[model samples]
Target: MRVRMTGLAGVIAIAALLVGAAPASAAPGDASAYGARLDVTLLGNPAVHAEPFAAANANGPTQNTFVGVDLPGILKTGVINASASRDDKSGGVYSRASTADVRVDLLSKVTGKISAELVEAECAATQKGLVGKSKLAGVNLGKLGQVNADPAPNTVLNVELAGIKIAEVIFNEQYKNNDGSLTVNAIHVKLLQGKLGSLGTGDVILSSATCGPAGLPIPMASGAGLWIGLGLLGVVAAPVAFVALRRRAALNAA
Candidate 1:
């Protein structure tokens, strides 16, 4: 009886290992629409896209931040704002978005400027992307409004981020599993809007991505080679599974 019990224990242990070792989904699956909760920073040039908007413009620093909160990727909400300086070398232009709540899809991607069309789709999609609540700050005019310029000698311009241009994005792709843990994947963005700006008005490319959720780091991937790199992660996780099973069984017996 003792020998039989030992054999049965081994079988159970192996079974547990297999179950625990079941592979991560091939894609995000139903949860693909969401991503791990994280704060994000986007940086790019704004002057390049300011062609028809401003003749000879230069963009200082283009940045946008996505605030993280406690929720699933699809139902998640966040405060997002961006700022940039566009100057025709004579006048100054600045941009701002008053703090507002927007529905977010952490795993999704935005290509060109965040146009009315894009905003509508995300907010309207079944797994909505961005659900903007209300306008935060009143739109600040850069050239039309006579505002104080920064250290630079130019017209003060403030444009609300009603539409934004994006060349690339580095965002977390989160997948919430039945186990409750999130599987994160970083995507190094690549797109066509690199040469565009907000409302096709700014002179730079706008980029956005997620930053946190404590741990679980996944690298950004842009091409075929990215897959090859990700494949190795599964191999690395195998041994860790065995150790986890042993610890669980020991605790149960005790």
Candidate 2:
């Protein structure tokens, strides 16, 4: 008996194999497997709260209880490992061990949701208590889009502040968890002096702040490169395999 397969069938088989080998997209919270953090600066005196532990603690996770915040103008080592450019005179390089997704929630009647990539987060005790702050200077608002207000998701808040820096942004002790990582509860955004779209700005205030759940771990660069190489090889080999198989079948039949 001769074994035979058509060109189309061979192509499909190869495609199936590649798809099976590919990894699933990292979901929210997958990135925070090690830990997570959130930093926010608001323009209001309103008090807010968040329950970041609620999701992990609903069933009680085995993760440790360590938390911190990132403040502006502070030189933290090895926190943000992206293509961030810093003009520090000391000349130090920062490399991240891994990246994670982090969410911040503004707990109040009217809420505001904010989140950022947890590329670098350091939690430690201070005279005031635990303070963790990360650098968020180069973040592109276009990627983040207009900040949305809760309940009325359609209402996207607009800010026209140029060279905007998430300054004076520090995570205070209000955020705490006994069995999990710290989640940002509330933030106070002081206008300092800026404009809010049409609302001519002298003083802008934030009612509450909130964060979405953490996202999954980003794909490893090495792994992705390997998969690409394999996929290309499969594409080139599929046609050759089909032709060879067809010739073999014809020879056997003859």
Candidate 3:
């Protein structure tokens, strides 16, 4: 009886070990989004500077608006609206950023003005794959030709003033982070020249979003069902082994 009980105990222990050895799904990732970031200098002096607006993450959404902005005749905008939001789904994460009614007076004398009715950026990560996209609507660059509504990744448009390239307007900028995350910027403006005649160099970004890598797929039978099935098998097998041992001992005694 003692030997049979020991053997049954071993079988149950093995069953428990099998259940514990099952693979576990990876942890879910995070997401973030923001709108309208400006870091520019005017006349060799740090004049116009503002952090990203309406930044949001898994915690909650954010929104803001400005009636008008005048950067001492260097930059100007009218009725700017920005918003950002993030969502965590079952097996993935999603983030979005949007802006509307944005107008920038880029060296009015040299380059007329740039305006966009709407700009948006989106990012999502799931078991299937990572997806990112940017949209520009009703955009007009005074001298620079028409803006591409659906530009490819990291598309750059040279900003030429008086036949001399001064800046670059990058659209749909995408970056693959080291930690398996992705960042997407709807529009990014980088000043190539050190000085725009008298205005200093700087960069501006609008409608940006980022999301971590996709979560691993969950196993079909990895949860409670797996443990229950293993437990039942052990219970039945243990009793059967005990009964068989008892019968054998009785026959040997007889």
Candidate 4:
């Protein structure tokens, strides 16, 4: 039995499977949501809200959640695993997980929706948490424009900042789950045409910060990379600048 959580056209279907199916009339707090069983290789308890729960109480859900993102600098990529209960009476966990989705409006030229799809699923029998892998899927953003952006690939909120095309800005990729943890992937941008410059479509891990929270999931300064990179750049530039100045001054005096 599979419960189907259908999204707008092209949206990934979140279906209840193998365990059994339920009607769509089930309520969130209904008792049936706690019982339907799934075909688990390593059966752990389906996700239940433990004590010390948040006011939202949204760890795993039966209803779909909406997420908004700031793109690029905020988050590049990540994945999310979720189970929804289909049994209105049995109201149990949806056997498989569904990837989150997003809609892109090409301002003027293009507009469509893109959804996230699970690439893999491995829920630990003892831990009860399923780890699912995903990629940017259902990406059909219509026709390509003069810029060469796939539109289907991920793009950022704004195309031009500081007169930079920021072709590889993927905003929807930046996510926030019901809770406020953040995740950032990578960024790529190259200049192209027009007063604003042409752009290309970009991609990212949707479940990351894009599906999660407003606050950052991890701290930025946690790594030594930033400090080292800055130090190296300064060290390499200082000597060259000093030597060039000295040579120029000596030649002028001569």
- In lDDT terms, which candidate is top? 3
**What Cα-based lDDT does every candidate model obtain?**
0.28, 0.31, 0.70, 0.27
Q: What is the lDDT of candidate 4?
A: 0.27
How many clashes would you count in candidate 3? 0
lDDT of 3 by residue, 1-254 (tens): 65666677767666665555443432456677877778877564655788667677654554555555555554444544444333323457777777777676654555577878888888888767778999999998787667689878898877776667778788999999998889999988787646444345788887888886765443324565466556766776777677667767887898
Which of candidates 3 and 4 reaches a greater TM-score? 3
Model 1 poorest ten-residue lDDT run: 116-125
Superposition error at 143 for model 3 (Å): 0.6
Model 1: per-residue Cα lDDT over 20-107, one tens digit each: 4333211121111121223232343222211111111113234444553333322233343433333322122223322233333322
- How far off is residue 148 in model 4, in Å? 16
- Badly placed stretches (over 4 Å) of model 1 are 23-157, 160-254
Error of 3 at 246 (Å): 20
Please, what is the TM-score per model?
A: 0.19, 0.23, 0.68, 0.22
Candidate 3: RMSD to truth: 6.5
Which runs of model 4 end up more than 4 angstroms from their true locations? 1-102, 106-132, 141-163, 171-254
Indicate whether candidate 3 or candidate 4 has the larger lDDT.
3
The alpha-carbon RMSD values of the candidates against the true structure, listed in the order shown, are 20.8, 17.7, 6.5, 28.8
* Ranking of candidates on lDDT, top first: 3, 2, 1, 4
Name the 10 consecutive residues with the lowest summed lDDT in model 3.
Answer: 80-89
TM-score of 4: 0.22
Position 82, candidate 3: lDDT: 45
